[model samples]
Structures are given as C-alpha cells and as structure tokens.
Target chain A: DQQVKQNSPSLSVQEGRISILNCDYTNSMFDYFLWYKKYPAEGPTFLISISSIKDKNEDGRFTVFLNKSAKHLSLHIVPSQPGDSAVYFCAANPGNTPLVFGKGTRLSVIA
Target chain B: NAGVTQTPKFRILKIGQSMTLQCAQDMNHNYMYWYRQDPGMGLKLIYYSVGAGITDKGEVPNGYNVSRSTTEDFPLRLELAAPSQTSVYFCASSYRRETGNEQFFGPGTRLTVL
Candidate 1:
C-alpha cells in the first residue's frame, strides 16, 4: 500500500507566480515530513521539512504547510523561477524508520 | 569531501547472474542505507546498517544482501538477477545523531536485467 500519495503527476506554472504541490498520507504515525527536489539523472536533494508539532515551515522562497487533522501537506513556492523546474517528491518518516515517499510531481516553471 | 560514491553507474545483467554494487562514503558516517527506485515509483529501502558489522533489512530486502565492514563501505549483493530487479539503486549515509541529520545520496546506479 502507498502510505504517501501525490495525486497530481505534473504541474505547470508561470514564472513569478506561486506554484503549489499537494501531498497526503494515510498513516497517522508519521511525525516528520520532508520535500526533495530532483533533476534529471541526479539524486533527490532535500528542500524543506516540517515537523508534526508545527503547522508550517518556511525557507526562502519555499514554504511547507502541514495539516495533521487532514493528514495532508502542501509545498508552496512563490515567484517561481525557471530553475525550479524539476520533480518534487514528498516523503514521510514515522519515528526512526525509513521515509515513505510519494510517486513525485513534475513541476514545470515557464519563462 | 567526496561524500557518498557508488561504482558501476550502469550495468546489464542476464538471468541467474550475480553481482555486487559497491558503495563508499568519505564523511565517516555510521549509518548507511540502500534504496531502489523503479519507473514511476519512488525510492524503496532495501537494507540499512547502523555501524560496522551490523545490517538490517528494510522495506524490500528479498533477493538482496548487504554488509557493512567499515564506517565507509557498504556493499549490496544481488544473489540471482531477475528482470523484476531492474531499477536504479541509490546509496545513502547519515550521521549517528538523530537531530538535524539528513541523508546524503550517491549518484545512483542503473541496472537492467534481462
């Protein structure tokens, strides 16, 4: 079973606009959530993370929001740039166990 | 530092063949992990090690074996190659500390089995 799910397979946004990617998880035990950005033929690089204790975390142009009641989380990038185009993966970690990842969403920022 | 490094970036294997994927890290991390990524599916953990001479199976460990002989080296072994095993494999390492620790991944190795 897929504990983490990214419903959208792909997303497109214009430069300088806000790009939002959504993810949901079925497991309630997950306390830490992370987002990773991956380019072609490269490994996934950590971007932003949010702990269950907080509802939101921000880093520069990226912001992650978590809703524990809904078991959903979203990543928002404001003023999206062309360089932001890549596959974004959402992962969840329950306690000390390994991360469970979503299928990934391909984000395309148009110039 | 070179961080994490994986050998044989690409490989092709036939059924019943056996080979080992080598991984090494220069950051002197005590925790190491192996994961595989298929087409649209995300990465799945295969095995992990806490320290030298210690190993444990992860999400998907069947048909695979792993060993950690030193703080820098963790090798993954494929006993019998199968078509279902064709995928991209990644090796990662992290410090023993739990807080503020993030895994560093290798470039990955693409394996094709026929």
Candidate 2:
C-alpha cells in the first residue's frame, strides 16, 4: 500500500497564475512532509517542507499548506513561471524513519 | 564538493547476471540510502546505511545486497538480475536522521535487465 499519494498525475497552469498540487497520506505516523522538484533525467531537488506542528509554510512564490486532520497537504505556487515546469514529489517521514515518496505530479507552466 | 556521485549512469544486464552499483558522497554523511524508481511509480527504498560498517534493509531488499565499508562509499549488489529489476536507481545521503533534513541525491543510474 502507498503511504504517500499524489492523486493528480499532472497539472497545467499559465504563467503569472497560481498552480496548486495536492498530496495525501495514509500513515498517521508521518510527522514531517517535504516537496521535491525534478527535471528530466536529473535528481529531485528539495523545494520546501513543513512540520506537522505547523499548518502552513511559505517561501517566496512557493507555499505548502498542511491539514493534518484531513490527512492532506497541498503546494501552491503563485505567479507560476515557465521555469517551474517539472515533476513534483511529496514525501513523508516519521522523524527518525525513512521518507515515503508519492508517485509524483508533473507540473507544466505554460508561457 | 561533489556532494554525491553514482557510477555507470546506464547499464544493461542479461538474465542471471550480477552487478554492483557504486555510490560515493563527499559530504561525510552517516545516513546513506539506495532507492529504485519504476515506471509511473514513486521511489522505493532498497537499502540504507546509518554509517560505515552498518547497513540495513529498507522497503524492498529482495534480490539486492549492500555494503558500507567506509563513510564515503555505499555499494548495492544485484544478484541474478531479472526483468523486474529494470528501473532507475538513486543514491542519497543526509547529514543526520532528523525531521526536515534534506537528502542530497545523485544523478541516478538507469539499469535494464534483459
């Protein structure tokens, strides 16, 4: 069974618009959530992270909102740019354990 | 620093063949991991090492083995390759096991078992 799940396989957004990617998890043991972005043939890069204690974390144009009660989290990118196009993965870890990654959601920002 | 490096960016193996995938990190991290990503699937942990001389299994350990002889090197061995083993493999390392600790990853090695 998948502990982390990204229901959407892909999402498209126009430049200067907002892009929202959602992720859900089944394991309640997960306390730390992270988002990673990857370009074709390249390793995934860390984007942003949020602890279970916080409901939201923001960095520049990227913001991550967590709803622990709903077992869901979403990533929001405001003023999306073409450079933001890539595959995004949501991962969860239980502090001392390894991270469980979701299938991933491909984001395409049209110029 | 080179952060993390993996060798043989691409490899093709025949049935019953065996090979080792090499990984090295210059960050001197104690937490090293090996994960495999199949088509349209998320990365699944294959093996991990807490430090030199200590290795353990992860979510998927069958048909694979690993050794961490030094802090910089962690190699994964696949015995009797099968078609099911074809996937892109990733190696990652982190400074410590804590919440929100980012794991640095290698470019990845694409392995095909024919």
Best candidate, DockQ-wise? 2
lDDT of 1 by residue, A1-111 (tens): 899999999999999999999999999998788898988788788898888888999999999999999999999999899999999999887777667789999999999
Chain A alone, model 2, TM-score?
A: 0.98
Model 2: DockQ score: 0.75
User: What does candidate 2's lDDT look like per residue over A1-111, in tens digits?
Assistant: 888999999999999999999999998888789999988888888899999889999999999999999999999999899999999999997667678899999999999
Which docking class does model 2 fall in? medium
Task: Give a tens-digit lDDT track for model 2, residues B14-87.
Answer: 99999999999999899999999898778899999888999989999999999999999999999999999999
Model 1 CA deviation exceeding 4 Å by range = B96-101
Instruction: Tell me how each candidate scores on DockQ against the true complex.
Output: 0.55, 0.75
For model 1, the local distance difference test gives: 0.91
lDDT of 2 at A75: 98
